[model samples]
Target chain A: MSEDKFDAIVVGGGLAGTVAAYLMANAGLEVVLIERGNFPGSKNMTGGRLYTHSIEKIIPGFTAEAPLERKITRECVTMLTDDSAVGLDYRSTRLGKQGSDSYSVLTSVLDQWLADKAEEAGAQIIAGISIENLIVREGRVCGVIAGDDELEANVTILADGANSLLAQKIGMRAEFKPSQVAVGVKELIRLPASVIEDRFCSSDGEGTASLFVGSPTAGSIGGGFLYTNKESVSLGIVATLSTLVEGNRSAPAMLEALKRHHAVAPLIKNGKLLEYSGHIVLEGGYDMIPKLIGDGVLVVGDGAGFCMNLGYAVRGMDLAIASAECAAKAVIEASGQGDFSAESLAVYRTLLEQGFVLKDMKTYRRFPHFMDSTPRLFDEYPRLAADTMEEMFVVDGRPSIPLRKAVMPHLKRIGIGTLIKDVRKGLGSL
Target chain B: MMEYVDVDEKLAVDKFYVDEDNAHIVLRELGPGDMMQFHTLELACPAGLYECLPDGTVRFDYAGCLECGTCRILCGTTILEKWEFPRGTFGVEYRYG
Candidate 1:
């Protein structure tokens, strides 16, 4: 019965937890991963894209056997202003290249695939249980209390999703602020695979990852996104929670409005809505990162607020995977040294600093702040972009004007100083 | 509330453990003289299952709930006191997720 106490006990069976468990189990450690749902991915949610660079670092040939939706080789960023739309569409064969490319994934299947990988590597998965609290002794977390069972471990990892309750109960995480988190609501619309291909202009098994700003949130400080799966599309909006209630715009209403918008309706015109899923997203970058290591305990993935939403793209799964790998490495090293002290487990932070996970997050730390303060980026800028495009293309039986002459006033409305300042700031942050 | 998007047939299958009388969730059941401050209940529901009755009671067809928790939050279930994830292996199983 003493052997029941595993080397490591992982709470939450999402991508981060599963990845960490897999890596640690692969390192020949006894790992038990617990999930509240019947399966790992059952409770996971994503806006539908996975940047594969980090995953490749772990499993070199993961995509060969992984359950993936599509290789997102084509991308679009659209700015919508009520009746107008300005789109920037770019496709490259290079995006389809092996290492640097990304793909759209349904978390339901993807999470299970990853958890299965960990199981294959000897991680024991305890499903259908929700851990209520951490078992702390002598100021160190040694296990978790789930229902009537107290499963012990040398080290316990919190890989639960954003704003983890267990982490908060242990005084490791803060009560999430509405300003720091965004509520994302997504709908899966099923279309014929060929229809999706033709509509998004991807003929050869490639897909589109498109984002929308402005009217999706009714010009609030949030945006909408669309990612094409093989036979369906994941379309949704993520609004800063701070702006929801006072602004009188609920997330579901915003989604309803988004689906009915003329600019967006055609994208999923004849499709069937497969699912409606919503989750809170952490938009807080570096400043929001909690104290990651504690005595005999560590936190990884969303529990540590490792997601980055840079407006153009949102990345968490890869960061979660990458950070979990680091956490697993730190845990493995600490256990081998027979030390799980907070001082010893601090190596996890070092691993993150050494890896691209924390480094990339630090780079974009200022971006979320920029997003929060700049209302024009969501409202004025998108309209300006759409209006500028409308002016450029519309031939109203008037004499053609020089391109600069036509576009200058729109730029002038948003002063040249503002544009330059924003450009410089954007470049600096990204 | 109004027809916006056509939901999949799978949502019609009920997966939640709900007690109608003791729902624990709070929603504004409009009265005869009350002007709807906002159609919040209708807006939060994506599957269009909520119907306002003549006596101001709401007929919410929770069977079609997607469990998105949008309405759960908007309806004043702070910290999700009333909402719980449907039991293991129940609820909408996203084939595509």
Candidate 2:
């Protein structure tokens, strides 16, 4: 609670803020990180997996010390109907290889660990304080005004998350559109580690990541996800806000349905519900990125919409980490030059563009639009898979039919032309 | 209609360190037919705090709020008078976020 100015003030103690503070403070810059929650990740929720590539660069071999739940060795994508599920389950050693591996995480623990790392690197960590507004003087961002305290800094970073009111206050970002964001509700179900290993068919410290489409969302423009923790399971449903507003089913109800699904219920049987949390996800891909650099200020993480929801995978934390690295590099360079103007802060954008943060985003810029336009992926495709599977697997005392003939009706139902068009667009978007 | 999981029971299982004096979320006065627009909150709020009464009104409780900000985005300035994170350390703290 010092009135003195610091070199940099980082807002929101999520992944982005902590990483930026860690890097800046490690470079001997006086940095302060302000967190609204009692702790860094207390108010955070995720579908629960982090791609290790971005973070490995920041702290090499971080898996040894990080509070990661389990290394994901099995990947699944199940197209689920009410009573049927068609899934592709891939279990391979390649998935657990170093530098490419991912782990299921509880951010409440993971973010706190990272925040501690930032503090150990000599950053002033302040928790349990909401930043009311930015202290913008003469059109140049000075720092933040939290309650009665006005903390000044030569540079300010907004890592406040998807619903950043402070960034909106300074017009650095705009309010999220219902289409650009999604609502995710989750339940952490606790079970014995041995039970989880037996249920998910994994060995010790190994886990499975599963995604479901169709009935879990009641065939909406979203899906369901489940990640195996060491002694618990992270199960949840995510639906686009626009569709949730229009649909009759609530997110919690969808989650409950997912928990009750014939294929999913058996997986979490006898487990106790440990926690229930909900969050807004930035799913608009690259198109949703708002202004990242302004006079004496920078925006990172979900605040800048650095998230992507590919049908097979959802990524935000890694992008947040990468973006924070870029911002920190830019800030250190700016500090050396003694310039905090918008022009100098523009280096953050260039760094992101040159790195995986913006490159990957730009590569998949058309994805969100594709997912929005393609309704059949959620509804018709799952039903088609179920029907196709029933035709092939269900043995009845009837005349034998050709395999192609058995699947022809389902294909005709979805129309071959429409399927081809969707395939082409999906591939092109990717 | 699909059966929804009992939200109250689900919320009861979670933790909320409530700040009784402050209601972080407040509703604006409703005009004619404004209640219809609020039915969306019933669908969006994961906590199930926003309830549309049969008598053409809405009932809300901030105690169980997950602070996901869905209602804030969906309603915006139209239906909400004020929506801020309950002063730090006073709202829902996810034990395993």
Candidate 3:
């Protein structure tokens, strides 16, 4: 092969890399994007929700032509126990209009389409090539070498996924401890559109996303999520790696247990299992994020641990894109000055901190730690509350006590003092 | 409807086994005849027990095996032994690990 020099080399063709390549190429820079998979998103997976704001910034008004499955119109958070579930559901027709803020997207379809957009903008994407290592010269990363091919560039961007080998190779991140990561296993269950709509109580083209906090992981320190697709449902469980190790459970067994749950079985009763996939997620909030910018390279997406699992939704893809866009802008600035030093790349960190990508992470940095230490909130509290309510409202032949009396006994049974402490901790963390 | 016959026509032996001394343990057959059974077991250990290969395969050290089977499930292929260490020392000892 010929040795070609580009202005920038992007290692990883996921959403972050593709967006960076797109922006750089549009700005009239020669860029090459190397992907390990057969295509941009062949090995990618998510819970099927994409925020429109960040994506629109990259490609304006993409929803009109993008491969979007459904507009998210309703969101539900269910606190479940062994026998009952207490849910908070919200539906808004305002979020289902032509220009919605978010939509459910299949990553395989969306990433492929985004790659096409990047290629249209003159970014050369070479797929099915695994980047072996970063070409470091004098303690500075200058390019990437992939399997007998050495590509030279002024700067290299690492947009590899959570289990990023490139970032580890360059010493941008250390070996991830189990506490800082999570293993998520998801299944795309195929069902008729009508059946999905009825099951989720959604209309045509309107979707629902539900989050579960208990029984799914079997009292582990993680949660479960179910997102509605066009003709399928994306259901999965994400547990802290440390929790999974401590609990002696496997992700597949947890998924099977979730499917067997009384509260979850009815929604996927007759659905066909179309595909099963699993991926690692960095869930340690802001504290677990690695060095964003190095001497001659910048890391984006899960490589930098830019994910927020806020008990209600997972917001990493948009943050990844936003961070990549910030890095692209920094690259443009660095290119003008002909400098690719650590000082020049520090602008990427400043931009991310100014945006919601890091600000939100810092705001809820204590969430994962708090959730891990409080298992009773996920398992016992919800059940006790539901049982108390059931007893108060059942009203058999026997005389019924006051509502306050029924609730107080249950609260006392679980130690009201500890419950209050947990509430305080939860409120503080949120 | 098409009728299916059992390929192994020998007497169906009771595959369920239990250690009489250990009441907490019970093992049962996972599949019918001519099928490989994959048993999952969990053990605790610190890091450095396994190494991830270039082709995304992980090799476990026999002496430091935790027997977690995390490597097996993450491999995405069924061409692994996925075994455990012997019931003795030379394994993981996790204390607040």
Candidate 4:
């Protein structure tokens, strides 16, 4: 068969791949974006609140034309014990306005839009083609072999989502251990617009994104999330595979249990279940990120494990978009020099390192381990707080002691001194 | 097998928030272990399409899926099934995914 060569061949047409392809093509380079899916976004899902800063940086005024569900106005963090929860909430008027914090979106729609942008910018996107391996020539990367066809390019980009086999095949990413990744299962339950507004307590076109602890997984490491969409709620559970396997549990069941949680049920109650999906997320943070660049190849998005789930908000798509832009910029520079060797592609890693992608990952590298070591924050503390609250509030004809006095014993029972130490460690890690 | 505690029972013991308006609700802290758990959950769902069979079961299909989450979300209360897209990198490629 004949080889079809181009200035660049981008494998896995997700956010990172699409953005890179779009940028390259717009800069007047020949680019081919290969996607294994029938279409862009057909198989993608996220708890998915899109951070607009990076996206707007790539495509200015995106909020006006992007398929946005709602501008997030409220955010909450809930600590749970099987049946009850205590939460911290933040809501601001400024957050509800456009071009502000972020918007909750479905990746399917958003990705399709992005791919179209790439197409409009003159990149050729071929969907439903599975790329089996990378074409490495003379120890310098060259292109990709999809089935029987060899597609050559000056540079090839692997944006093939979190489980990025292309990167693995090319030796850029090592075989992933269970600890280096996360499994997230999400349900898109269709609720009436009014119900969603009333349930989450948001005004028209305003939404809330909340994170949960406890009920989603039995004592395993991971959490649950719920993000309000235009007419539905995206609810899901996520946990580590090693822990799940060690604990002998299942993820879908865990997601159901999360939906069954008292705090989550009413919001989803009576809502029709529309769609459910899941995907593995690279939670390896900075420590697990693989070699990002090599001869004729660059890695971006979850393929590079560029997500930061800091327990406040899950920020992967924004990082993916940023990294893709960086890769595109690097590829553009490489094309100008007519070189695609490791030296030329090293710019991708350099740009990412200088940006928040690597900087923030470095900052919070210790957080995952610290949180893992202290399971009590999820298991013990919530129970203690609940006990204290109950003891301090109920009136049953006993001598009425001061609320503070009533709760002191419960605090002692759970070892408040230890709790304080954990908090100190957590603050330091974060 | 130990009797599994109801979400409400667990919540009562832990002091998780129960929206009097809602049922079986509780919130807990997330740690590294939880993050790993999330990753596993994510793989099980795989683009939110298809079902995960019981242990030692393998299934793959390239077509007949409506891109729905039926088999996945409702496994066994519905019956376990697998409906995967192409291997070696297949399924949705969201520009934003």
In the range A305-375, model 2's lDDT, one tens digit per residue, is 99988899889999999999999999999999999999998999999999988999999999999999998
> Which ranges in model 3 have alpha carbons more than 4 Å from their true place?
A94-100, B1-97
Give model 2's DockQ, 2 decimals: 0.74
lDDT of 2: 0.90
Query: How many clashing residue pairs appear in each of the predictions shown?
Result: 0, 0, 0, 51
lDDT (tens digit, per residue) of candidate 1 on A263-351 = 88998999987777767778889889988999989999988999898888889989999999999999999989999999999999999
Give candidate 1 regions above 4 Å deviation: A1-3, A399-409, B1-95
Question: Arrange candidates by DockQ, highest first: which order?
Answer: 2, 1, 4, 3
**What are the chain A TM-scores of the candidates, in order?**
0.96, 0.99, 0.96, 0.96
Per TM-score, the best of the predicted structures is: 2
Candidate that would win on lDDT: 2
Sorted on TM-score, best first, the list reads 2, 1, 4, 3
**What is candidate 3's DockQ?**
0.04
Candidate 3, residue A219: how far the Cα is off, in Å: 1.1
Lowest lDDT sum, 10 consecutive residues, model 1 chain B, at B8-17
Return the lDDT, model 3, position A65: 86
